[model samples]
Structure formats: structure tokens, C-alpha cells
Target: MSLKYRDEREPIYTCDRVVHSETIQALEKDMQGVKISMQNRGLNVDVNKLSALIDGVRLDKDKIRDSLYENLHLKGKVNLNSARDIALILSSQLGVKLRKSRTGRYIANRRALTDFNNPVTQEISQYRNLERLLSTLKGLYTATDKKQGKVSCIYTDDCPSGRLYTRDYNLQGIPELGRTVIYADEGCTFILADYDSFELRIISALSHDKYFKDCWAKGLDMHKKAVSDMKGIPYELVTDKERKLGKMLGFGLSYGQEAAGLARNLRTSIHQAEKLIKAYKSNIPEIEAFKQETIEKARSTGFAETYFGRRRFLPDIISPNIVARKKSERQAVNTRIQGTAADIVKFSLVALHKAGFKIDTMLHDGILVTVPEGEVEDSIERIKVIMETELEGLKLIVSCKTGKWWSDCYAKPGRESSPK
Candidate 1:
């Protein structure tokens, strides 16, 4: 018998061409528009409000430090801002036990702080949050394009996902608070559309998981359904908390989270985490098998390929070190899911751009398009159609929202509606 020969690199090259051609042009054009609009609507930070907030945080930190010193009857003025100093004070003066975190931040980690009610720990966490907020503000100030009056972010397409990464300013990683400062230009509105459970949908289609497919077909909330089935509760009776846990397990386990890591994330015991994993796997055993097969293939071939043929070299999979091998295995499994989702989004962007829509930003699984206020509805419908279109036989559920502000696009109630 003669074996058929096929060049695996052919499909990858084809995808590369698509990504590097019109898609790159579309992304660059849209990014330029976004940058100009942002510059015109330069983030208006209320300096007085920010100053007041910072001053209040400093005062609160001082009060907490003074209270601790008075109550504990400790020594000379200790630097509460210093984690090491706080740990020393707590351990030596107050006889409070302290544990070093994975990053060596003593008692500063939420996981290491056993007692949430501890005044000292609470104060430290609050101070840190405020400090982080201040640091973020400083970063934003530095990132702001002074001459252009806008924040200019660098976009890179070098990742295996083929997704555009906003570098330097990291607009993609901005926190909710940071996003509030961003506004849409006058006469233009933000139209945001994101794939719902994009990776899980891809996994379902790839694995042919009956349960997942049926849920997607029926438009049921998979997170709630999974929680209900796993916990033996009625779907309607499943609490938000339970559904959240189910979502965490459903997505986390699929991405190769170990029981211990899952437990740590859930703040539960490893046994409980293992049980949750087992229940989740039992519901979609095919996905588990698929993931294992993916890992094995990467281990054997020293690389993994996404559904769309994008290849990720995994040389560490063959490493003698167990930790490196395990990390590589996780990356191999995760890359397929993440990279495929990225490709799907990129494809949608290219399609939409070709259709004459103005894309403002390309998120990991979402696209934010700037449209005239009068054309918001039309734009939303068109975006939904483009985003939900089948890619490699996998269809996605796309949700869209329209607002005058970027934050409002996601924050407004009842703003999100799926276009059937």
C-alpha cells in the first residue's frame, strides 16, 4: 500500500498569506483611525479628583500604620509601605505568622494572607490597590501622545495566534478603571462584538462533543448547564457563584490547569478541585481525549498545529526537565484553542473590512468598530453576520453592543443582543 503524501506547511503558508495581506492592511488602516480618534478625544483626567484620591489613600495608609503601632506597642516608625517591614512587624512585634508568596512578596499576596479580616493585611491590600491605580495613571500619562493629543499604541502580529498585540501602552490589557478615560469621537459610536465562549465552541466542534453541541445549538448558557449537570442541580436553580465555578473549571481544565492550580484559584481543596475536574471531564470526555492526543502529538513531533494550520514549535516538550516539559505540554494544548480563536477573529476582521466597515480595535475575541451614530444598527447587524460566520466548519455565537463610549459599549445594561 502506498501512503499519500501531503505538505502540512501548505495550509500554514496560505493562512500566513491571508494574515499578511489584506488583513494586515485592514488592521493597520483601522488602527490609524482609532489612534487619530483617540488623540482628538484625548483622555480627560480630572487632576483634582486624582490628587484627592491619592491623598485620601495616603491618609488611610498612615492611619492604619498608626493604629497598628499603637495597638501593638511596637518600636520606632516602621515603613508600612515595605512588605518586608510589615512582615517583620507582624511576625516579631505582633506574633502574627507570615508566609512568603511565590514571588517572595511577604504577606502581600491574597493567597498568603490567611485572615481577610486582619486589619494590617486589609490595609496593605488597600494601599497596594491604590498604589497600583496610581501607577497605572502614571503609565497612562507616559503613554499619552502629547503632540498628537492621543495615546498611540504599537501593534504587533508576530504571535502564533496571528492576533494583533497592542504593545507599549498595552491598550489590550487596560483595566476597567483605565478604560473609563477613553471616549468615542463626536458623531461616532463604538460598536463592540465578541464571540461567546469562542474557544469552547471550537473545542466542541473539533471534538464533536454531543452535550456541548446540543447546548450551543439550543442557545443554552453552557456554564449554567455544566454546573447544573455536574452538581445535580436544576439549571434554573444554579446560582451565579456555581456557574462561575463551572465556567472556571470548564475553561481552566481545558487549558491544562492542574488540580492544585485549580484549587488555588478556586480557594478550595485539591480533592474538591479534582472532583470538579472529573465531573467536567465526564460530561465531555471526548474533549479530554482530544487534549491528551494534542499533547502526545506535540511531544512526538516537537510542535503543535491549530485548527487553521498555524504551527507552534514546542521544543521544550522534549526537555529532560519535568517542569519545562509540563509547561510546554500546557502551551501546546492552549495554543491550539487560543490560536484558532484568534484566526477566526482575524478572518472576521478581514471580511468586515472588505465589506467597508471601519474597525477601531481588534481584541482577542472581540472587535470594536467605530460607526456613525445613524448607522450603528446596520453596522451591528453586519458585524454580527461577519463574526458568526462559520470558519473551518465551526460556527460562533457573536454578541454586539453599541454605545457613545467604549466603556459604555460593554457596561450598559441590555446593550448586548445577538444577531440571529
Candidate 2:
């Protein structure tokens, strides 16, 4: 093994390539406080519950592994952790038509196989998910502070997405099923506040789209409305499945998803994906126009700006190479709402932190707070009010829930409690 260390004694100088913001100085420093609060607050988890969760996931993984072996005769034959081994099995044994890269090597990545219509693919995906869940649960237990029974997660803001990312025991990446064991502290309840359809609202706000704003104000289903308007069908005729397709087109095309990627995810042909994109664009041209405008401005300016005035300089936006330039254009479209959503979440975190709240964790567009049982109602009201404030002229809608555990907040809050 070899070790390389930074030369601490070397002279340091600012290269001056960074984009400095004059208005966001305090905001930048306060974002650090948000991270500090998360680290210091630690995490409250039920050790016994977490152990049970780990056991359940391991059991499920074992069952899936056994099924996969029985189906494929792979018992003691192949390493399940090795994608290449499974990919070989998929290509050679199962006769699945695996995709090849430009170099003619078989692509065995999850993205390549996740949408494949094979039972083995489903089994493998399930096994992998359960395996990861088991590992994450074990990591949480290992990272738990023995004396305090709190899991410590490390967060950093060096994310290209401009959001705080959790490392080590990555709480932000935890699935809903895995979060059930993360409970509120004794005598405390968890308050969850998230922007309703956050990225969609950001796109609408940025584009000054009156239709989406009206939908928000009237409490109408945005997806259903889009389908109704685009397909010339009654809103009531939009089935759950069709509305789901609408959601896919609405969100995906807004973020500049190409037809190939959409087709892969939708398990459909590229032509159908293109038609969906066309339908979405034809009916809701405001968002489409906004996306194009964002890319055009960034292509000319060599940078993208979020709603909160954060700038991400894209040197590739002006590149002479077509591939790099198009990729940069897609990134510019994504940066508009995603970057704004990140900033909005950070702003909410700072506001909540200043209002004397202990932030449990921050997800992409949500914040969790631990409040005393007596203060639950008041906390929810204050948090919703704080989080629902206007952002760049569009009203930010906040949805609040109180729960005993993190996962419970996903459903309607129904946790009963007594005062401490």
C-alpha cells in the first residue's frame, strides 16, 4: 500500500477561478450552520427495531438468493456480488440479449438490466436491494454511539447538485422501508415539512407559468390537468395509469431527459417516448420554452443561474464539440430547478435552525425536526409557515406531518403521544 499526503508546508494561493457571490455571503456561512446542527443533533434510532429490520432484510435476501439459485442452478457457482458473473450467466446461460458498449463489451450495470423483462432480473434487483438494506442497517448499528444510542452521519456540501450529501451512514439515501427504525427521541415527536411537488413548482415559478400556479392555487392535480389539456380528454377520464405517464413526461422532459432514456425507463419504444415528449411540449409549452431559454442563455453566457442567484459556470456549454455542448445544455436545464430546489431547502434549513429547531435530517426538498410532544402542533404550524413562504414570486407550498418514526411521516401522521 502507498500513502500520499498533501504538502502542508507548501505555499497556498487562490487561483481566482471561483465565482464569488456578494449577496449570499451570510447565506453561505449559514448553510454550514445547517450541517453543524445535523452533525451535533445526531440521530435517534431504536436499536432493537433496527436489529429486527436488519434480520428481516437478511432473511428476504437469503430467500431471493435461494430462489435465484434454484431458478438458475447457481448455488455455490457464482459470486452474487459480481455483476460480471451474473452478466455472463445472463448472456450465456439465460440467453438474455444483453447490451454491448462501444468497445463490444457486455454492459452489466444495474441501469442496463433494471428494466429488462426477465424474472431473473427482477430477482437480482430484489436481492441486491435487500442486500444493500442489510448492509445499511448494519452500518447504522455500527455507527451508533454506544452511550447515546444515536447514529452519527457525516454531511458535506461539496455536491455537484448543490445539496448537502450524507456520507458514511448515508441517512439521506435511506429508503422508506429502511427508515422505520429511526425513531424520535423519547418524549419527542418528529415534524416533517416538504415542498409539495417541489421541482415542478420551481419550474413553474421560474417560467412564470400561470397555469401551474392556478393549479396550485385551486388544488388541482397537475398531471391529470396536463393529460386532460394535451389529449383533449375530460380531466375525470384520465385514469391512474395515464396520469402516471403524464407525470413521467411532465417531470422528465422538464429536466431534459432524452427519448432513449425515457424509453428505457418507461419500458417502451423510443418513438412512443418521443410522442409523449411532443404531447407534453405541445400542451405545456411554457415549461418547455423555459427549459430552452435556460439552455440558450447558458450556452451564450457559459453559466446557469438558479432562482436564488447561485451560478454554476459551465465551460462545456460553449464547447465546439456537439456532444459536450448538448450535454452541457441538458445540465443547464437541470441546474435551473434542481439548483433552485437545493437553495430553497438550504434556506428553509437555515430559517428553521435560527427559529430554535433541531433538524433531524434534510432530504432533497424536505426537512425533519424533533420537537417536544407538547410542542408538536405549534412546531408544525410554525414550520409550515416558515417553509411555505414565497420564493421568487411563486408561493412555496409546504406539507407537514408528525410521526413517531421517520417512515411513518410518509403516510398520514397517526402517532399517538403523551407530553414529557
Cα-lDDT of candidate 1: 0.69
Among all candidates shown, the one with the greatest lDDT: 2
- 292-379 in candidate 1: lDDT tens per residue? 8989999898887766566678889989999999999898888778866776676676677667766666678888777888888888
Report how far residue 375 has shifted in candidate 2, in Å.
1.7
Instruction: Give TM-scores for every candidate, taking all chains together and pairing residue i with residue i.
Output: 0.82, 0.88
Q: What TM-score does structure 1 among the candidates reach?
A: 0.82
Candidate 2's residue-wise lDDT over 289-372, tens digit each?
Answer: 888899899988888866555567799998899999988898898878897788778878888898899998988788889999
Q: How many angstroms is residue 111 displaced in model 2 relative to the true structure, after the best TM-score fit?
A: 6.3
